[model samples]
Target: MGGGSFIEEVRMLGQGSTSSSWKWWAVIGGLVALPMCLCAFCMVSGLGVALLGTVGLMAGEVRPAREVAEQFLSALRDERWEDAYARCAPSFQGQLGGPEELARRHGGDRRPVEWSFSRWSVEVKNGVRQAHLEGTLTTASGEKYAFSIELRTRAVGSGEAWEIHAFTMD
Candidate 1:
C-alpha cells in the first residue's frame, strides 16, 4: 500500500511540473511582447500627432509673411510687448530699442484696439522679398487710423522667417 501511494505522488508531481512549465512560458512570452507592443503604440501615436499638425498648417493661408503680420498685430492688441518685439526684424528691433521701450511707447492711449488688413502687395527690395499689408485700426479712444506694415524674410536658425520690417500708422 505504501509503495502504491509513493507512485501516485510521483505521477501527481510530474503533472504539476508540466502545468508550471506552461505558466512560465506564458510569463516569458508576455514579458518579451509587452515592450514591442508599447513601442508600436508610441510610434503610431507620434505619427498621428505629426500628421494632424501638418494638416493644421496646410489648412491656413501658407503665407509666412501674412502670418507674421497678423501675429504682430495680435500681439500688440493683446499688449504682449515681448511677443510683438520678437516678431520684428533686427533692424526694426534696433529702431524700437527693446521690448520695454516698445511697451512704453505703445501703451495706454496710443495702443491699438482692433485692426485688420485690407490689401496685400509683394515686392523685392535690395534682393529681399517683402510683403506690404495695408490695414485699419481703432485706438482705445475709438479713433480709427489707417496703417501699413512691411514684412521681410530674414535668416533665422538656418531657415528663412518673415519678420516685421516696418510698421507705419497714418
Candidate 2:
C-alpha cells in the first residue's frame, strides 16, 4: 500500500523501517528544531539582542519619550552633536541647520554637564502622541537652569518613534 500521511509516517519513522519515512522525519525534525535552537542560542549568547538593535528591529532602547529625552540630553552632555541632532524631529531639524549648529549652540561653555527630569506629561491627540518634560540642567560653569522639552512620536517602520519636537532652557 501507499505510505500513510506525513504525521503517521513520522510516527513510524523510529520503528526501524527501511522505507523513506526516515527522510521525511529528518526534514520535519530539522525544520522544527532549527528555529528553536537559533532562539536558544540568541537568548543565551545575547546575539539576538545585539542583532535586534543593529537591524532596527525595535528602534534601539529609547522607545519611550522620557528615554528619548534622556538620551538626547546625554548626547549633549557628551558633546556628541550628531547623536543629539539625530533625536530631533524633521521639523526641528530644519530649525537646527545641522549637527554642526547643534555643536555650535550647545558645545563648550554652553553644554549641559548634567540634567534631571522632574515632571512628565504624555497625551495623544489627533493620532499624534506627545510628551512634555520639565527639568533642570546644569551647565559646564556650574549654573543650574530650568528647562522644558516636548517630544512627539512619529511613524518608524511598523511602530512609533519618539523625537524631540521642541525645547527651551533658561
| Top-scoring candidate (TM-score) | 2
In order, the Cα lDDT scores of the candidates are 0.81, 0.84
Local accuracy of candidate 1 as per-residue lDDT tens digits, 7-50: 46445555646465555556568889999999999999999999
- Candidate 1 vs. true structure, TM-score: 0.60
lDDT over C-alpha atoms for residue 44 of model 2:
72
Per-residue C-alpha lDDT of model 2 across residues 42-132, encoded as one tens digit per residue: 7877976677666573333224888889899999999888899999998999998999998888888878998988877777789998888
Clashes of each: 0, 0
Q: RMSD for each model, in Å, please?
A: 12.4, 12.4
Error of 2 at 158 (Å): 1.5
Off by over 4 Å in 1: 1-62
